[model samples]
Target: MERISRKAAEARVLDLDGREHPLRSLWASRAAVLLFVRHFGCREQAVRLYREKGTIRALGAELVIIGNTVPCFARAFREDLAITTPIYVDPSMASYRLLDIRRLREALLSGGALKHKLSALCGGFRRVQTRLDRSQLGGVLVVRQDGAVVYRHLSEGADDHPAIEEILAALAPRTSDEAQASL
Candidate 1:
């Protein structure tokens, strides 16, 4: 559990196309979902994210998935999943560390971890450790226009994640045109 300061404003990531840009550059809407996946193969959360991509867009937000792996892995995952959300590779895991996303060995005891593990196992997904840090963990941070992290959820294990409804609640537009009309 290392101290992680909010330095996302300065963090940069290499997009799948090998182009490097500041993490904030993806904030082309009301906010951006900075999702950090432990590795390239972990697809449960990714699948959910893929499904929720359009909902996120309707909130005036963009979804960016970042994985702690090489560019090839990132590209392959994006293509295989046909993910339209921007994906990035960070072999160095600079973004993960800076965001305080770390490993947890006691995940088995963490609430819902056992169930999640069981779910993964039943889903035909094996926990084959990767050459990279597979236990690195996952996280979600909602970044607003000012680079401020309005909401953050760090996983306790591979399966840990904020519920899709929870994320959408936090991301829903603060005001819609209908509401603005009243003002």
Candidate 2:
């Protein structure tokens, strides 16, 4: 994986309080697992990452959830999910564009999307109403403090995300040579 682009790292997102903050701050102090969510109402991916927050932190990384909506929607998502992981909003979706996470019109009707919806329903997470773009997908990025993005998974459809094991492996310590070679 390559280091995060300066444009993406510098893209501004709003916290729940509506304050603008750069995305790089997320990994400045520690490695971070950044989950760019489809929307605030898509709880499937968010809940999955939330469940693994402890394991992620155990690897000396923080998990940050970013949604494409306003602060109110993000606040509601946090309350609805009852999770402590920091959630942010990018109403303009500039970060998504900079990261090359695209939107597919067929994503909503894809077989994988259907399977994910069913799985979320069976898991007891109800679908909430959202006005945000339904075609927009989400992605995962594992980034080190120095700005190297060790792992990146760009979603092909709604609810598509990288495996927990894959993300954890990216966060796992690597020897200097291994790290250098990956770069």
Q: For candidate 2, what is the TM-score?
A: 0.93
Tens-digit per-residue lDDT, 26-47, candidate 1: 6644678888887877777877
Q: Residue 176 in model 1: shift from native, Å?
A: 12
Index of the highest-TM-score prediction: 2
Question: Each prediction's Cα lDDT score?
Answer: 0.75, 0.88
lDDT of the structure predicted as candidate 2:
0.88
RMSD of each: 4.9, 1.5
Off by over 4 Å in 2: 180-183
In model 1, where do residues sit more than 4 Å from their true spots?
A: 1-6, 28-30, 106-115, 124-131, 175-183
lDDT of 1 at 33: 83
For residue 109, model 2's alpha carbon misses the true position, in angstroms, by: 1.7
57-112 per-residue lDDT for model 2 (tens digits): 99999999998889998888888879898889999999999999889776376788
Give, for candidate 2, the lowest lDDT window spanning 10 residues: 104-113
Least accurate stretch of 10 residues (summed lDDT) in model 1? 1-10
